[model samples]
Target: MSDQRSVTRSDLVAYCDAMLESSAFQDYCPNGLQVEGRNQVRRLITGVTASQALVDAAIEQGADMLLVHHGYFWKGEAAPLTGIKKKRLKALLENDISLLAYHLPLDVHAEVGNNVQLARLLGWQIRGGLEPANPRSVGLHGELETAQSGAEVAASLERALGRMPLHIAGNDRPIKRIAWCTGAAQGYIEKAIALGMDAFVTGEISEPTVHSARENRIHFFAAGHHATERYGVQALGERLAAHFGIEHRFVDIDNPV
Candidate 1:
């Protein structure tokens, strides 16, 4: 069992922050060390969100620290902790389990970022960032090894993510050039359209996205937010575990959206 291995909370946080370059990204939420818990971590738990369910799972697993892609204290949120936030923080504090979270940093990290990991998972090679100007752009454009129909692309996404994706066919052309970003990036379809991608994929599809896709004649796919973001955190957890020689487990909270 890896329980015998342990890592100091400071060391773990430092390693992650350095590896992810957390300070570089302008993010909605604060990255790294969201909640303080135990000083020494032996078992680490990772998940997509630091929800109440995930917190409970970490506690149940006897995790010394919890790492996640989504954490608390988003910009413009209420400064005072109350209700669900209070309850979740209380649980972590009482159990002495530290909470570590990364938002845009994890999403944009080159090696373990969600976009890159998704590409690796789907067997597509990235051609370039969706936004050519921004070196650290969140959305990316690429082509599948072989051209496939829009339905075939949706089927491939469903198979990879274990959830059905909503595919909006704007064109009948086989998908060759594709652009994608994970988690509620439907608005980026405009960029994809501007780039003349055959299709665009993201976690959520907004109302305007449908019309934009149809009008622009570019296909759109809304894969699950949770499903697409799963790989990066898991990859981060596995890396941390290997580096620190600690036991790591990824707890799934079954978010279908």
Candidate 2:
């Protein structure tokens, strides 16, 4: 069913790992080629997470590999394959579908990174990293081409990401400077505040983040984690497909959280 040509699995994995610079960052899970399937891949599927639903979808699509931002084997998770994890792995293995994942490395990529892709979709101008001293800073600070109210910014995010972001207004003034990190990066609000950003945007929120936003007088937006991270893997997949002349499809398994 795939119209695209096939490429060796090793070449595809090597190219992705090198492009993402997976070795540069210490991450919770392995960066690339988490599981091996066929020696050659013709059709590839990309998603935000490798959940059971996503695995099932990939199998249905006849995907040779399932590439994602979040995959199995986290730092503290039990080693045994059981419960939901067991089912997910079983589906992939039985279907002969490879699983490839990248965590912080995918976050820090300048071109196809989640933060950069979000900015591209939302039209934010990138100025620099949240932690400028660290080469692989996960968060970024930037400016809006034109100043807009907190409410207006929220609207833009809702339109672009197709999800209503939880906005916490800290001030009445218009917002020009902003900082953002995708996927459960609410903790980086402090870094944004230290940079004197007018607002901070990230996926997922904690109770303390509200107090910090109110006290620090910076607007906060908790966009859904799955929504924020959806773009990077898609972008990476598209790029790989273009480079290798292989079929690529981004199957979005919606996650409200």
Candidate 3:
């Protein structure tokens, strides 16, 4: 049990913005404080996406703040708050719950980001970035502690992620070096191939990824985007709770994809 305490919304947003350097990345959506509700946050709920189910669950839990990876208002999405969007926004507003979102910043953070967290969970020694030139590259290249076959890698992913990945078998060779970027980064497989990685793992697979993996002789794994990205937000929530002595709960709404 932990002592109960409350943190102001402004302070929480400032801490996250500073820690994640939200302004550094040109993200698809705004980084922090999408919907403001309460000033004092005592109970916080963290999730992968700010979907309707998640919002309802947060409201049920009586959370003062809902912190998530996916938030509203994307670059090309319709500006009008209609249908599902309207309902979601309405729930938060009616309940007076603040919504905080961190997108690319949460993916690239050196310690608490999704990529590094996944690496830590799977026991991969991170070597460098997929795009070595880009300081804010979201993908990472690393090596396994020991060489293992493509099947072995898949099995490890299944064990760690709780979902079997869709494996595109490239070659029969063992996988020692690999690269990974979570959440729809299947396009970066080429970067992995160029980096001489034996295997590449990402959230979603495209039509051409199969051909590319087969032609390039590198194993490819399309792990579930939701499963792979569940860690960073939880890690951030834990950090916040420990730092501020506020109650934190991670509500996981199952999503197969």
- Residue 120 displacement (Å), model 2: 0.3
Better of 1 and 3 by lDDT: 3
All-Cα superposition RMSD per candidate: 1.1, 1.0, 1.2
Q: What is the TM-score of each candidate against the true structure?
A: 0.98, 0.98, 0.98
- lDDT value for candidate 2? 0.93
Angstrom error of the Cα, residue 93, model 3: value is: 0.3
What's the TM for model 2? Answer: 0.98
Highest lDDT, which number? 3
- Tens-place lDDT per residue, model 3, 1-257, is 24678999999999999999999989899999999999999999999999999999999999999999999899999999899999999999999999999999999999999999999999999999999999989999999999999999999999999999999999999999999999999999999999999999999999999999999999999999999999999999999999898999999999999
**Which lDDT value does model 1 have at 34?**
89
Clashing pairs in 2: none
Candidate 2 at residue 143, lDDT? 98
Which regions of candidate 2 deviate over 4 angstroms?
1-3
Per-residue CA lDDT of model 2 for 30-121, tens digit only, reads 88989889888999999999988889989998899999999989999899888898888888888889999999988989999998999999
Q: Write the residue-wise lDDT of candidate 1 on 42-83 in tens digits.
A: 999999999999999999999999999999999999988899
- Residue 253 deviation, candidate 2, in Å? 0.9
Q: What number of clashing residue pairs does each candidate have, in the order they appear?
A: 0, 0, 0
Go through the candidates in order and give each one's C-alpha lDDT: 0.93, 0.93, 0.96
